[model samples]
Target: MNINDFYTTRKNVFDKLQSSNTATKILMSLLMACFTGVMAQVVIPLPWTPVPITAQTFAVLAAGLILGKRYGALSQILYIVIGILFVPWFGEMTGGLDIVLGSTCGYFLGFIIASYFIGSITEKYAGSRKFKRAIAVIGVANFALIYIPGLAGLALWNYLTYGTMLSISSLLFMGLVPFIFGDIVKILGLGAVSKVFLPKE
Candidate 1:
């Protein structure tokens, strides 16, 4: 019930489906992208920070764990592209190249990286007996990937637009401090959900 076991189990499932279903895979990927957009709408704006608390990160984690690496990453990539070009599916239902080039852009890029990281790790560890714990760990790792870029992006945008360098303490306060507990809840929630839904091989 470690990474090797998980990889083998996933390989078996994929091998079974490899024969006649490229279309289903494509459809599912698109749906995951759409699902992320929908999740973005469930947002609560923070008074102090430009970033809001949204369900999008949970959706991103779910997509990666459920869809596997390639499709999971594709789903997020599609979500980002759609937001940048045509959809108001980002936080606060806002989008366009302006938003993409805005303060939160780092987090958007992080979503893609996080999705790939989560999906890849999940696929690698599919057969682990301690599935729930492993998923929780994976979720935490992915969150770090998301937040690092997010904080950096915020600082970068601020500097470029206003010529003011944000202090490390200020960045942590705006980007990481308020959300610590919430993100912990999300990691645990995803772990519990995975325990119920994923096969423990």
Candidate 2:
């Protein structure tokens, strides 16, 4: 098929998926949740902190772009709930309710909210076919939304464990600093390719 035909084909498929029944939507969300779990397995261990580098953020951001607001958040929620309630779907092959108390719990919480941010912005801007707009929307929302809670959780965990909160500098170093390079790469890469990824209008 020609380039235009390929895009048309991709759009038709996405439209069908989006317009499917409630049951299909649930299944699609579950699929994205499972994808998040799988991506969580892409771990890069960091000895200094509980938060390791992983591609979960990449997948979560993509979920919002592809699934839109409602289903994107559902996908993240399902991933967290399943990890807390059932399986070891988190990075480093870890999970369960006890994981909720760990240092990275804030990041998990951030993931849900970040999905919403991405989805909401994506719905508004993706159809515009504006390349820079896509980058700005996804990059800003994903980075800010995820890190705000992520750093908060890191600080809180430290406080609960040590009985003293580390300085903001320390939290930034532990939770945000280490991931900056990788996060930017992911954001730029995702934003650049987001048009092909998002459901076409």
Candidate 3:
């Protein structure tokens, strides 16, 4: 083949690969970010904190289940990035690092990491028909990941004195107990919902 022709073919191949990667990134980023935003509106507003709880659990769990580990993480990171870009896609239509500085910042960050961890674990157990088991794992992982970081963030943000039971109790009342049952319901509901959406692989 002529050198020019060979060069042209190689360039075309390279362009195709680049296009494919871009398409994959777009599919993973825009689609998943939109899904997460929609889930935020499906809310159950609480009187405790401005950070209303929502079906974000479903979005987080489904991200990992459908997209797997790396893509799932990318999807969540995209959601956060877009939210920070001032789109107000998060809970209560809130956005920016101001939300991050709020009481639920740790949980906000935890959501992304939890999605990755759950996705990684679920991807491994995605053998034959271990779907329920995988969901259970994801649920527990999501709960702990959100709860621990959330509580810590709240306590630290308030600067609760170590020996002050009132501060400790306030933290529990505000952070942990109110949402415990709701979160459990969320875990079970979202886990099952994810199974329906996830491909049987």
In order, how many clashes per candidate?
4, 0, 0
Tens digits of per-residue lDDT for model 2 on 1-201? 898888788778877877889898889899999999999999998888888999989888878877878899999999999998897999978999778778988888888888888778767764633456766776776678888888888888889889998887877778988898988888788776766655446
lDDT of 2 at 68: 79
* Full candidate order by lDDT, most accurate first: 2, 1, 3
Model 1's TM-score against the true structure: 0.86
TM-score of 3: 0.75
Residue 76 CA displacement from its true place in model 3, Å:
1.4
Full-model lDDT, candidate 1: 0.79
State model 3's lDDT: 0.70
TM-score of each: 0.86, 0.93, 0.75
Candidate that scores best on TM-score? 2
Candidate 2's C-alpha runs over 4 A off are 199-201
Q: Candidate 2, clashing residue pairs? A: none
- Model 3, residue 44: C-alpha shift (Å): 3.2
Worst 10 residues of 1 by lDDT: 126-135
Using lDDT as the measure, the top candidate is: 2
